[model samples]
Target: MAPPLDPEVLRAALVTRGSGWTEVEHHDSIGSTNARATRLGRPWVVVVADHQSAGRGRLARRWDAPPGRSVAVSATVPVPASGAGWLPLLTGLAVTEAVEATTSLAAVLKWPNDVLLPSDDDRKVSGILCEVVTARAGPLVVIGAGINVSQSRAQLPVETATSLLLAGARVTESTGTDLVVAYLQRLADRYAALVEAPVTGGALAGPTGLSGLAAEYRTRCSTLGRRVRMTRAETNGAIDVVGVAVDIDAEGRLVIDGPGGPTAWAAGDVVHVRLDG
Candidate 1:
């Protein structure tokens, strides 16, 4: 078991920062930090948990983190509904940077959501989920990030997942706390940029081109420039679309060229297809 988070230390490190993080709350355990933040409905607040019992991933997939083994954080930020879709991608950048900074490991995004450490067979080390909520002030996006910090390989919930420690992070008891702080700082900076950039009516979606968020996402995303097999969203079928993922369009959809032509997918399970060239 990892050392429990000291709320005082976290508060001390973050409360005075200029990130607009209004409140930082730590929990010994929680069902889901996202649920908590959504219920709170306060913008610029961060809710963190040492253990998340009912954490979820995209498509209602369960994300299991045993007590003290991972860092689960949900941060609330208000954004225009039109720009809400970019939050998850922005959060992915935050997680990638934080994990790389904290663990000294090369982290890349597996487009749409999962954060992967390439050294660990491209296994996912973190995951992001964004939920749009209606708030009195406006629209709020609860950005949830679950990062595996100290879990050993045997302790992982799946073979395709990895932790910072397993991926060569020199972790101490403060590893979880360190990751949370770094992640939130990165998120706050990126979120501010997302909010400040001008939104224009163009081929791209959201306030991306002006902000350069989409361009940055493309650089960190490993899904681009690779052949992929995507699970069909409509039928829940496997490999309905097999193509080369070429780009992320203005609206943040995955652009792929298949047997027919270039198509943009809004959401689906994408598997990188390794081929012998």
Candidate 2:
């Protein structure tokens, strides 16, 4: 098991840097940090758990890693209703950066939310999910992420997944804390940019929502310029849509070119196939 987080140390680390964190809590075990953060209803509050008994991923898939071997956490952020759609993309970027910093690895994103370490042959190092909750005060976006940290070779849950330690991350207590702090800082900065975007006239849904945010996402996205197989949102039987992922449009949809034409998908399971030569 990993050492428990030291709140005082975390607080001092941020304060000494002329930065500060909002309410934060750490638990040795929990059902899900996202569930806890959502239930708490406190903006900027963060909850982290060493182990989750019932963590979930996109489409209700299970997400779990051994205690102290990963980062399973969630945070609540205040955002305008119009900016809710941007949270997932922004969080993906934040997690990717944090993993890269902690691991000293080139981390890339597989769109719609997986973080990969190239040293692990593009194996997944983290996953993210963003949710919006309505409250009388306004809208709150709850973001959850799980990052594999120090799992032994035999402990990985899936063949496609990898831990930071396995991918050459300096997996110490301080390294994990740094990873968490880095992610929170990045999220706070990106969220500010997203909120400052013009919400009037549906501007929040366009590329104008955040200056250069789309381009940045594109640069980190491994799906772009690659052939992909996507599970269709609407299925007639089990048919899927296979195409080349070419872009992330103004509204953050993955634009693909198929046998017919370019179609922007708002939601689906995307599997990276190969680069389109």
Candidate 3:
């Protein structure tokens, strides 16, 4: 088991000069960081909880971690509704970057919201969820991230999930705090650039627009250049689209080349297909 978060240390580091943070709150136990962050209803407010009694993941799936076994944090920030689709992708990229920089783990993104460790057979180390909330000021995006920190193999909720300790990354209390600080800093920098990117003629621009970010996401994404299955819900029911993930479009949709040609999906569950013969 890793040491519990040092709340005082975290506050001191994050509330420093020009950290781009308005408020930072750390909880020893909470229902959900995302829920609390949304209620906070302010931009640049970060809420972190060591234990979530009612944590949830994509598609409202329950995500539970024992006390101090994971890093659960949520941050609210203002973002354009037009570019809202990019929040999850941006958060995933930021998490992987932070984990890799703070520890000895090589992390990669699995489309929309998962951070995976290839060394561990693509097991997930972190999951991200973004929610757009309307406040008196404007629209704010609450980005929540759950990172497995010190769970043993037996303690993992699923066989596909692994923690920093399980993946051979040392997890001291300071290191854990460092990871959170790093992710917040990176997310703030990228979000600032993304918000300033202009929207003209209803199309995002290239390079100067989200193209640079799109390109970066593609490079870090392990879903590209692989056969995959995408489950999407339609008017009728949920349908599975099997295809090769070709690219991430300018608007942050996944472009899949399948039997019916190419289709772009804004939201769906993506699973990489592995063929063993």
TM-score to true structure, per model: 0.93, 0.90, 0.94
lDDT of 3 by residue, 118-142 (tens): 8788899998888888887688888
Model 2 residue 81 lDDT score:
51
- The residue-by-residue lDDT of candidate 2 on 6-98, one tens digit each, is 666555554344242477788878999999988888787788877888888887779988777777879887765555665688789998987
Q: What would the per-residue lDDT of candidate 1 be over residues 1-277, giving only the tens digit for each residue?
A: 6677777777877777586887888899999999999988889888998899999988778999789888889988887435556777878998998887777799999889799998888999998888888978677888888888889889998999999888888888777778788888888887777666665663333444424888889999999999998886576675678899999876678999999899998888898988962
Query: Which candidate number maximizes TM-score?
Result: 3
- TM-score rank, highest first? 3, 1, 2
In order, the Cα lDDT scores of the candidates are 0.83, 0.79, 0.85
Better by lDDT, candidate 3 or 1: 3
| Regions of candidate 1 where Cα sits further than 4 Å from its true position | 202-211
lDDT computed for candidate 1: 0.83
In candidate 1, how many Å is residue 271 off? 0.6
